[model samples]
Structure formats: C-alpha cells, structure tokens
Target chain A: MNHKTASNLALAAAFAGLLSGTTARLNAQPVSGHEAGVSGAAIAAGVAMTAQDDQKLPKHSCKGKNDCKGQGGGKNAGKNSCKGKGDCATDGSKPKN
Target chain B: MTLLELQRRMEQDVRRPLTAELTMQPRTTEGESMDEIAAAYIRPNSELTSFERLEIYNRQYWFRVIGAVSEDYPALQALLGDERFDALVLAYLKQRPSTSWTLRDLSAHLPQFLEQHAEFASEQHRLAVDIARLEWAYVEAFDGAEIEPLASDELAKLGPESTLALQPHLRLLAVDYPVDEFVLAVKKPEEKAVTSGAAQLRQANVTTTLPAMAPEQRYLAVHRYDDVVYYRTLEESEFRLLKALQERKTIAEAVEIIAGEEQVATIQQTFALSSELGWFCHPTI
Candidate 1:
C-alpha cells in the first residue's frame, strides 16, 4: 500500500482493535426527530442578522424588535410573544379615568 | 405568592426574558413589570448608570452569546438569512432556555434541534447542525476532560464479546451539509475552497435554474483526539460502522459487518482511518 493507503489501514486496524460496549452505552442517546427543534434556515438567519449589524448596514425586519419593526415582524413581536399578557392583551378590559 | 409560586415566578422571570424573541429586551421606561423584575435580578456592572443602561446590559448579555452562536454557525445563518435565524434562535431560547452561567452551554442541543426542524432538509441545514455539533464537541474536549491516550494492548485483554467505551467528551454526529466546508469557511472566511464532493454537488444548482438535492442533507463524525477537536465526513457504510460500534458491537463484529458489503480493501482502509481518530472505546472501573 502507498503511504495514504498504509495510514488508512493503520487507522482501520486501530479502530478494529479499539473497545466498544462502553462507548456504545455512552453514545446511546437518540437524536430527536422533530421539525421545530432543528431548522437550518433559523440558524442561518441569526448569523445574517449579526453580520449585517456588524457592518452597521441598513436592513429590514422580521420576527425581531430592534430596527426590524417593519421589515421583519411577521408573527414575532420583539421580546414578548403575541399570546397572553402582551401585545395581544389589549382586547377585553376597559379603564375609565 | 406561595413559596412554590415564588420559586416558579422567579424562575419564570429569569428564564422568560432570556428567551424573548426580540432583538432588544423589554425594559421599564417609567414603570413596567419587566423593568421591576430587571431591577430585582440585574445589577449593572458597566459604566452606564441609568436604569435604562443597566437594562441594556441585561439584554446585551443574551444577544452577545447568541451572536457568538451565530458566529459559530454561519452556514446556518446563510441558510436562514438574518431575520429568520434570529427568530429561530429566539424560539430555541424560549423552549430550551439557558440555565447555565456560561454562553457555551447555548449550543448543547443544536444538532438535536436541527434534527427536529421541518424545513431543515437542505444542505445548509445539515451543515449547520453538523458544525454546531463539532463546535460543541471541541469545547467539551478542551474543557471537560483529561485522559490517557489509547494503549495498543488495551483491547487484547477484552473477551471476544466484551464492549468497549468511548471517552466522555467525544461526540459523533450525522449531518446534512458538508459541515466541514462550512466550518472551514468560518476559519479562513476567504482563503479556502469548498472541496467536499457533497458540497460541490449541492452547489451545482446555483448556476442553473434547477434546484439542488433531493434532500440536501449530509452526515458527519465529530470527536476529540489527544485533546484536539476533529471533524470528519462519514459514508453510509462508515456511519453504520460507527453506529454498530456505538451499539456495543465488538471490533471483530463491526469489522465483519463493514466488510460484508464493502471490499476487503475498503473495509481495511476505513478501519485504519477510524482507528487514528481514536474511535475505539476504553472501558474502565
């Protein structure tokens, strides 16, 4: 075998020789298969927002509170969700002075 | 509030603001509930004295760490764009809110989180998950443990059916994008070429109108070797091999399985490659 091939073989032998049961137990945790938990798009957007800020460039908003009020706020409304005790809480009660 | 209620409320107060999806934290301009909570928990450590400035510090703390995570997973940022990524991170903050005092704990479930994303079938998504996994592993490898190197004779003493154990800080991941390429981009930003066959194939659609990838995901292996964090690509066979080993299969069994479909030469090659990575487990008392 050539150098790369020899090295590859050595690595394989080493793998073959390495211990396993305890390792298996340690790695037994399963990856959850849920959609909301992992989204590449969500992760990417975070980076873009930061990079844009680092450049101090003009930007649009979506799902955020800062300058993104118009461009970004689709369903998100800054620090508080639109559900209870927040922006949505303005409906029922009346207070007269 | 009852003690239980007070505890619950305090915990909620600490956690809710930390996970809020907004760019800036909610504050008390004059007299707001959040501001009151902030006044209670936060003590300003910066030069700014105004309560407003103090609140700003509280908000900045979370954003800073999140931004660091964004730095750690730029490919993810690229895939989600600026707005959505922040939103997703905010969502992540809400559900699996941080409990640690350090920012590094922020990435603990990133790979698993990405695994659960509905739209994360894209190569970028896969790359993001994988790089996140590697980055976290690297952190753990550096901070979590100190151990002896593999001794060649260690496995010889084991019975044919005995199971070996992997190191505590090591992690193996399967991802969608060529995460190595994504991390490489982060490391050099400008100099490196994207070389993985998977990455090239996924990118091929950019020049044309065609959409790339039926599923656009990739697989990965992340681990620690002699205190250095290392990431490597895994073929289907290789991943299964690792999986089997992870499932407590003996080395001979794992080799037999890997060698079943693959050529003896390739299996031998793979075994050698995995060995150097210290993919073997070491059992202890």
Candidate 2:
C-alpha cells in the first residue's frame, strides 16, 4: 500500500482497538456513580481521566461578601461563583464568600 | 421489474416527506398513492399489509435521524425546550434532509437554519445562535478527524518562514455569549438533576434563578485530545493569530497580522501553551 493508505489502515486499527477496549471496560463495570445517583465522585473521576493535562483551567469561587455577583454579572452568578479565573486562590477549591 | 427494483422503490417511498396523517396510512406518491406503490412492489405477510410494513421503516428512519440530532444538541434542546426543539429539528430535516450516509451530518445546517428563520430570531436570537454554534462545535470536536500531533521538538524547529498547521479536529469559534459553560453545565449529571422536575418547578417559582448570563464577546477553541473533547477559552489576539496561521500564513506573517508588540508576546505565550496542549500538527517547511 502507499503511505497514505497505510496511514489510513493504522488509524482505523487504532480506532477499532479503542472502541473494543471501551466496550469491554463498560461491560465489566456496573452503572455505578452518577447514573446510580451516587455522589459526583464518579463523574469527577471520568472527567479527570478524559480531560487533557495543562488544559485544566482554574475554577473560580466567590470571595468575601460578594456572593460571586461581581464575577460574571449574571442572575445565576453565585451558582457558578466557582467558575472563572484568579478569583479562587487555588484551583478546584471553593472560595470563601 | 426485478426484486432489486422493487426493494429500491419501496425504500424511496418510505423515505418520503412525513405527513401529519397516521403512520400506516397510505399517502400520494408522484401520481400514485402509497398503497398503490406498495401493492405494485411490496409483498405483505398475513399479519400486516404492505403499507403497514413500509410505515415501520418510515417511522424508524425519521426517529433515528431525530435521535442523532437530539443527541448532538442536548443543550440546544434544553434551551428551546422539548416541543420547540422537536419542531425545529423536524422543520430543519424537512428543508435539508440527511444527504450523507452518516447521521452526524443531520445538524450541519442547523446553525444556518436558526440564523435565517425569524421565529428563532426573537430577543433570545443571539443566545439561540450561540448555543447552536457551541453544540455543533462540540459535536465536531467529539469525533472529528485525528492527526498525529506535533511533538515539542517538531514545533521548536519552526522559524518565521515555517507554516504551522493546526490539528484537523480543532475548531475555533467567536461567540457573543459564554455558551461553553452552559453546554458543560447542561451535560453534567448533577446539573441535570438540579434543573429537572420538582427542583426546576421550585426554582421557577422563586425569583432566584440559575446564574444569569450577560452577553460578552468570547473566543473559544474546541478540540479533542486523548479521546475526549475540551473547550479552551482564547484571547481575541490569540484567536486572530491562530486564524491567520490556519489560513496558511507563515509565522512571521501571522505575528505581523496581530497589532502591537504586547499582542505578539501574548501570541508567543498562547503558541507555547497550545503546543503543550497538542493543538498543532507537523509544520509545513
């Protein structure tokens, strides 16, 4: 095969392998965690696994008495007070409001 | 005609435009009724008529198309609600139809459709458009074509004359609203539970609502890495620089396209960050 055809075949093989692996993993595990209405831990784990490193943007939190109102200036501002940058001192931690 | 001809005719008849009448009811086809078409081609079993058998395939086709679009645009559905979203999908399909073999192309015209239609062009028109764009970006990022990303060594060899190529799966979007967050919120299981059923009713009753979204200009890069899709917010300058690069501009030309030395610095930082994030592919020398 030509180089392009060989590359295409390799990609197809890799994709097939990924799908089979994912299917096997799903079959072996129970639908626990989020689907079972457990905690958000399962979802968090899944996100961590899939999300790229260095692209984990920091989460913002409400500071002092602001209640996150000054953050995004939305009606549901406080809801995601933990969203945005530089507001939270640490990544993934809730800010003191 | 041969059996192949008959099968083809039956498939064509079933794939016709869905009418408001009953599913199994025969409708007109060209000059002939559906029953006449079916009678001429399809062989019916003892339990059901030829038209009834054909209707089953008809409903399945429509449902599958609708389901694929819905799966791809859950956030859009949540924003427009079930009834309106269903109407929008049906209307969209009626106009465009799925010409591609894959169901993924079903919503390719949706953003443009929403743009042209005045019904969705109300006060929430911008929001609707932003949601559609974001959803489509996510869909494209999810299963878009993949390429072997450029390594740090490969990226470092690039000079002003070198042309940098972005990964095929990367999609750059300039949206008026922060629809990326909204898309993520709607997709999360916890957020779904909070916004659904009794909680939704109670929240609706109370003046306190889900976080409000004030319109703001936003630039986003939606891409897939490690088999998962991600939305990375970008600065306006960075977005412009990347756009220029993607358009086949050389590194020096891309830098010249951006205004001021500060912007050039920002572009450098963004380039470094993007490189680390595997946003680029082999550079064209």
Candidate 3:
C-alpha cells in the first residue's frame, strides 16, 4: 500500500481504538437516576460502524460522468492547480512567487 | 450617474452570476434588464458588446471568489467534486454575502451553513462538516491575531487560583473524523515530473476517492508557531481542562471540572507540554 493509504488505515485504527477506549471508560462509570441508561460502548460502536462505512467509499472513476469534467477527469486534476497563487497552498503559508 | 452610484452598479453587476452561463442572462435588482443596465453603465469595447464587457467582470469576480474558496477548502472540493462544490459556494455566497474586506473571511460560516443545509453535504455529510471545521480552524490559526504567549517562567508563576487565557490564535476543535491526516494526505507533494502527454493522462485517471476515515472523536488544538499553523492532538481530559481554562476558569477549578485524581498525573503532563508549546497567554491572577 502507498504511504497515503497506509496512513489513512493507521488513523482509522487509532480512531477506532480511541472510541472503544472512551466508550469502555464511560460505560464503567456509575449512572445517576436522572441520566438515561445509555451504553457508551454502544454509541462508540455505532461511530466505529460509521467509520467502517467510510472505508467502503467506492473508487470513484471519471469515466462517463459529466460533472467530472475539469475536475478529477482532466490532466491537471490533482496537480497543484494553485501554481503562483500565494494563498492557495495547503500548508497555510504564503507561497513564494 | 455619480461615481458612487456607478461603483454600486458595477459591484452589483459583478456579483450577479454564480457561473459563466448566467453571464448571458444576468439577474439584476428591481427587475432591471441586465442588458439595459450594462448599456447604461459599461462602454462597449471594439471586440465586445456592453453586456459582454460587463460579463467579463461578472465571470472574473465569481471565478476569483470560487477559486479562493476552493483553495482554502481543497479537501471539501475533492469530496464534493467540482460541480457540487461550485453549487455550495454559490449558495453560501448568496446566503452569507461577503461582509469582510478580506476574501479569507468568506468561508467563516461554511461549517454552520453546511450543518443547516444537509443537501449540499451529499452522503459524506459528517465528513464534509468535519473537513470544513478543520479548514476554517487552519485559516484562523494562519491569520488570527497573535497575542504574546506566556513564557515558561510566567506560566510557572501562575498559582492554582490563577486563570490562564489561551493565545488568541489558538483554536480548539472537537471533530469526529481524523481530518488532520486527510488534509495532510490531500496536501501531499504533487508529482511535478508528469510532463509527457501519456503520463499526464495516466495521472488524470487516478481516482480522487479519499479513503474512508474512521469516526473517532478528536480534541484538536490548532495553533500557530513562527507564523505557521500546526495541529496538535489532545487527550479528552486535557481538552476539557483547556476548554474550561479558555472559558476563564481558574486552574484549580478547570482541573476539578475535568481531571480526576487518577488523571492528575496526565493533566500535569499535559499542562507542562501546553506551557512548553506556548498554548497560553499571560494569566489573570
């Protein structure tokens, strides 16, 4: 896998772990009478399920799609379309002309 | 017509069309014919009609605004694709017209706007909102006012009763998606060597489908150091404590609010790290 894909997977795993841990901790805590008997683990699991759904985003192709024109379809798609435009750089720093 | 009146007319004309197609039949206030307004205000050049001349400004204005917004929120653009993003920008511009002198402030309400209008979010509604929030936070950290950060010694002098204020440039975000990583991935260095036609075609075919980020609640601190914006991930307790402190709670009070006896060591570590990172301004004793 490429670095980007690997990093994304790592982040997803980390987030899953975080949610699981937080949910378990919250679940272990005593619930007051006024508080609803909501399971934090269940909530976290639901969120984890959503994250898993995200991982299932089908590989988008520009073929036969009208809206993809000049977007992910063209030769300049993911390239630095912001060349010479100082404020457009992703690093939040002004690009040197 | 007076210069101010002319200026107003031009401004109105410039912001008329959300897209180039609308330039041909641009809308005007009070049901005034666009052609008539253009004819009255704009002088036709050798190569263009009065309306065409005015259309140039109209198209340019939209292009510049859209371009700036697209640059600021590239991940959002990628997620929504060009068409939906265009629609969102046009709608957002109409709802929240540019009131600030700087174009940087144009996207300030985008997150809230996305929240209210779920149609624009597509299926990735939550992802879009998180990305928008992250992008806006980055923008704020980049250009927000910079207050003098408290020195280590100054932070050390603060008693438990002292209320510490965070630096003006600091922004706290509670996000569900790991958007920071996604942003970094999107901003990864583009291959500059794809000059040949065949290679360029291959590059174009590469899918823009971003990997699905797992939904995890994250406490993020976006801050600037040496004029460059950076993201710092914070623990939940640390986030809560900092948030309380930001709300003007005294250190003791903030600690009590979020940190338990078991979390005291972790909170102390976070406090030291925050101080070292210059996350605070001068404390109000």
Candidate 4:
C-alpha cells in the first residue's frame, strides 16, 4: 500500500538527513515525556474536519416544484428541509415519493 | 442565591428545549440552577415568532455537531445501519459531554466509547472501534499540527548515553482487524462500499483463521507530516525501540533490546518504511 515514488524517495532521504533539526525537540521536555500543544492541534483539526463534513451533505428532495404544489410542511419544518406545499404538514415527516 | 446565580439557572432551562434530544442534559454553568432562575435573555419577541429564532440555533446546533462527528466515523455508522447509528450517536452525545470546543475533538474518544458500551456488542463492536480509530487518525493527519520534526543534531545530542523523548502528538495503535484495508475497500471510486453493506470477503490468512494470533496486533504510529497528521506502522523491533524511547530509554539500551531480535533485511526495510512515513521525527537536532 505504500510504495514510494521517485520524488517521495528523495523526500524520505532528505528527512533522514534533517535529524539535526529535532535536537531542540529532545531538549524541550525530556523529563515530562508528553508532547505539549495538543489542544491547538485539536481545534485546528476540528475546524477542517467540520468544514469537510459540511461540504458532503446529501441533497434534499424538495428542490423542484413551481407552485409548492406537493406536501409542504408547517412552521416547525423551516425553509431548509420543508417545502410548505399542498398536503404538507407542519413537521414535514412524509416523503413525497 | 444572588441574581447572577438565578440568571444562570434560567439560561440553562431555556437552552434545554433547543436541543434535538430535549431529554439531553443541560449545560448548567458554574453550578446548580437555583430554585428561582432569572432569565438571561428576554422571552422570544412576540412580534417575531419564537419558533423562528429558536429553530435557527436549535436545528443548526444539532446538525452541525452530528454532521461533524459523522465524517470522522462514517464506517462505524455504515456498520451499524442508519437507525442504530443515529440512536447510538444521540446516546453518545449525552453520556460523553463535549470538552473540546470542536466536534473532531469529540471523535477522539468515540472508539473507546463504542467498545465499552454494551448496546453495541452485537455488531462485533470491536470492529466498529477499529474503523473509528483509523478514521479519526486519518482526519487528524488530514489537518493537524506540524513541527519540523527532529533533526540529526537532535539525534546526535543523545550521545548514545542519554535518554530520548518521543513526541506526545505521535500516537501508536495496535489493532486486530485490517481496518485500513476495509476503509480502502469502501473508498474505492468505482463502488461505494460504505452505502452498500455485506462484509466483503477477505483473503484467508494465518492471522485471520488461526487462534494463536486471532487478535492480530497491528502496530500503528500517528504523527504529523508537515502540517497534517499521518501514520504508518513499525515492525516488532521498531515498535519496541520507539516504545523504549517513549518510555525515555537511552539509545544504547533501546538498541541493545532490539539487537536481541533477529536482524534481517526485512527489519531494516520496515524501519525505512516507517521512518519515511513520519514514524520517527528527525533524530534529535
């Protein structure tokens, strides 16, 4: 699953050579043993995660219909999920199909 | 109590009805709500319908949290079926309160949650946990933090005599099932396995059928690559060495521990693969 390309191979070797950079890492908190700053990562990652989830929404059914002719729902259903068409109730529970 | 105390209680009560699961516990700030609570905000304006304003936060809040969590653990939901997944997620919301401000933070503990919960066992809930863990790590790697990582200078600083510390953000996981494989199977562009159920048959292997290694220990290391969280597995020796390092073992001691094992070309290959995948930060510098 992880065979590297020619470019990635070079990157790997370069990373290997960069071991000198991490010396400060060893110095930062050798005694405590836990890496700090996880909360920052959590929040940053969370924003991206949530944004990605939002983009993946499933399409709603009531996009079409000229007159709101079908079963439109009541006030509680809101404009987003409810069409408020004929035979439509307040809750928007029934599927038009 | 004082007016402030009473004000907080009323706010909690008002917020309670906004939740999709109204039965879910309220976030009573600072302490318990007083017998007589004060209103934090004026009652919904009679001019503008109360339901309109309230629905904005109520539905959006519920959908936002649920949607965010759904992405992190899609495979788990796929395994559980829509109805069961929704029910469990609702229960999950109540039992485990959100401590982290973001929904992704809420996912960090979901795997552990499903494993311990009795309601989920029939699905071989362990499998669900594995899927969730992998999904969570993938999300973490997709957009997490990054450090330049350790450099050769840092590795040299150890001097072969000193103990080395492992980064905290790096996580090591040992799982049983081939969850990554399963996840891959679902993500294939041609067919959407997540929607279509029926567990795909896997190649029969010693690990799958044999009782000795029934619960195969799949070693995984999770760390950030540049700006994202990425992970790869290590071999027996590599895992032990990292474990030793995480435990603050000296280089000489950790190497000594590994030297006891059979050193073959494959082991070195394993280390190379792991190191390439950001398993180990640059040595020390």
- Best-performing candidate as measured by lDDT: 3
Q: 3 or 4, which is superior by TM-score? A: 3
Q: Indicate the docking level reached by candidate 2.
A: incorrect
TM-score leader: 3
The fnat scores of all predictions, in order, read 0.07, 0.00, 0.00, 0.03
Which TM-score value belongs to model 3? 0.69
What is the TM-score of each predicted model, taking all chains together?
Answer: 0.54, 0.67, 0.69, 0.57
**What would the per-residue lDDT of candidate 2 be over residues A1-97, giving only the tens digit for each residue?**
5544543443333233323333333343446464444222222212321223323432111111323223322212222332344333212223455
The structural similarity of chain B in model 4 to the true chain B, as TM-score, is 0.68
Instruction: Compose the digit string of candidate 4's lDDT tens values, residues B180-208.
Output: 55554443212222332466655322111
Query: All models, DockQ values?
Result: 0.05, 0.02, 0.02, 0.05
Could you tell me the lDDT of residue B249 within candidate 4? 70
Residue A19, model 3: lDDT of 37
Models ranked on DockQ: 4, 1, 3, 2
Q: Candidate 4, what DockQ?
A: 0.05
What DockQ does candidate 1 have relative to the true complex? 0.05
Q: After superposition, how far is residue A80 of candidate 2 from its true place, in Å?
A: 34
Worst window of 10 by summed lDDT in candidate 1 chain B: B202-211
**How big is the positional error of residue B264 in model 4, measured in Å on the Cα after superposition?**
5.7
